[model samples]
Target: MSNITTAPFTYESLSQLTMKEGVLELQVGPAHAGSGHMRILVWVEGDTVVKVDPDIGFVHRGVEKLSEDRLYVKAIPIVERPNLVDTVNANLGYIIALEKLLGLEAPPRAQYIRVITAEISRIISHLYGIAIYGIFMGSSTVFMWALADREPFIDIMEELTGARLTYSHIIPGGVRWDLPKDFGERLEVALKYLEGRVSDYEKIWMNNPVVRARAEGVGILSGAKATELGVVGPNLRASGVKCDVRKCAPYSVYSDFDFDVPTFKEGDSYARLLIRVEEIKQSISILRQALKNIPEGKIIYEDYYKRMTPLMKSIYDEKGRVKFTSLLTSLSPPKGQSFSRVEGGRGEIFFYLISDGTKNPYRFRVVTPSFRNLPYFTHVMPGHKLADVPVIYGSIDYFPPEADRR
Candidate 1:
């Protein structure tokens, strides 16, 4: 390690050094003040990396504080913006946490709706991650194809909720509305289409030599290290850990669905990517199973409406939104804190929600998937060449600044 201050270390000159001493250190900074600009620095002393840093916060929006000011249920759509791709996972985690605190249970059919939306969100979220990974690896065709295929999932969400990205579909007691007529047929078609596209994704990217080269053995995270660092979702599963919330805890109607949590001992970037691909396929199967097992009933919690004020019910009927679900607006509960972890697209989203026998929650905490998976970039990005930084970065599938900087 070189004795240097906070001054910049240019990669242009560092690339000239050739030695068996310590490795190059790569770090990123801002290009301009308030410009949200980014800079990359590297110090190549030898063949081993001694230091690597990722500096973020140029785009910090203070989401936590924003959530604090909003009403209990008002925070749902707001919190989804940071990890917009995994909207349903975010929604599910929040709803489950509230359910634990408020002592509420969604109907079986409503749980099935949640399952369907969550799986669809998983498909789109994986699509976004893979496409971004493809772009980071300089494959525009793969990126375009992956993004284009994500459109069908988005269409499904739009029809179900009248919103493309922010569904606000899940509530404290239950979901907003029941499945539309022919929902089963339409979803089956979408699944068939997704099944074929996933095959093509493997052909062009997963199996491609260049993509595999960039991913395999790039960011090798062992099972022990993954558990120690608290990695979750596909990244942790890649390390051969079969600990899935659905399997271990079996929230909602997950116990009724049949699926496998894919894992690998290699724990490399390629393994993580493959885990997601397999997960998407698995989610489709779960959706099929859920559709088959779905029961007939009210989508929203039956009595939540009866408890609401007449004005609230009138608004609910007029707007067709579940924001006014009684369990949402005037939630008072036993004083306690509960945690709920759900498998998100990036990883597990864990929530710590506290209730104090009042309409407002005493405290709320969320640990997003990217936050837990950021260790890969900080600890694993070094030892690799500058050109491979984006590859490893994408494989981890982080939302950059949003992942860390906490």
Candidate 2:
């Protein structure tokens, strides 16, 4: 085995080794095979990678800067665009921070609904990550099955929020709509079907000898190193660090649900893969609890609910949707700053907002999980073979669009 170094790699350090003997430099892509929307610069000695530097910013939409120009309510869709597979959690993080500055809280029913959709979004994201990982491992069957199973959950989200990928269903004060009349029935069926499919996945993919051979001991990240690197979500938990933003800092009725944060001590590529599977099970458990025990109440805050016009109230009464008033578009909170964080599908999504008591935000900043997890490419790829690059990248479930959203 090649000696693995744990020191941080910077552009200056990488530049210093530019023309070292017996080393070859390679650029992975802004056009990815499976690494998503960023480029990776890899330096290899023989067949082992000696260094890696991720070149991000390909998908930079300047979401934070853009949020400053739009109204608080309008920024929901803008923020959701960065991480389409897990939009609800991103939406939830921003809404929670904005609510703190606005001095508002979502109604109990709205909080519960938010929890339900967030879990559903978590499931959708995990399945997408698993599918992409399967493709990286050359298992077309796993890829297809994982993606096909995602459709049922996507349909459920569309039923509730009226949008497939980017729901933008969450607003500053609360969710945009209440649960559909048949939502419970559809969710039950989908959850049951997915439970059976999980078993099938275990049998065909997780337990397969070929997969185990490839992933079991590859790209190990020790728990200490993981914490030092500030890894989050399944990647952090996979290394046996018992830290989840939801458990550490409960937000939006997450404290009301019963679920376990799964962790594995192996810290290898296989452990990272399995932790996501376990998380899917926990998300399902949360969904069941949220659905069964949800209280009946208005979906928006009382203040926002009271501002509904007669026509809007009638529409909400007849269709269960919350129509926004013009007041929301001109919302200006007190001149103060607030921060909020949520456990997203990939990891902890954090938002910082500064309000100058204007119609638009003074400043908006987001630290996405994928951006936090980006250092893994430099830290974990150095000692592995060139071919193991994709394995390590896929194992971390790094989404480039989310990472590059400056």
Those runs of model 2 whose alpha carbons end farther than 4 Å from true positions after fitting are: 1-12
Query: Which number leads on lDDT?
Result: 2
lDDT of each: 0.75, 0.89
Candidate 2 lDDT over 169-240, as tens digits, reads 888777888888889999999999999999999999999998888888888889998899898889999999
What TM-score, over all chains together, does every model reach?
A: 0.86, 0.97
lDDT of 1 by residue, 150-239 (tens): 998898889989888889888878888667787789889989998998898888788998877667777777788789888888888988
lDDT of 1: 0.75
The candidate maximizing TM-score is: 2
Q: Provide C-alpha RMSD values for all models, in order.
A: 5.8, 1.6
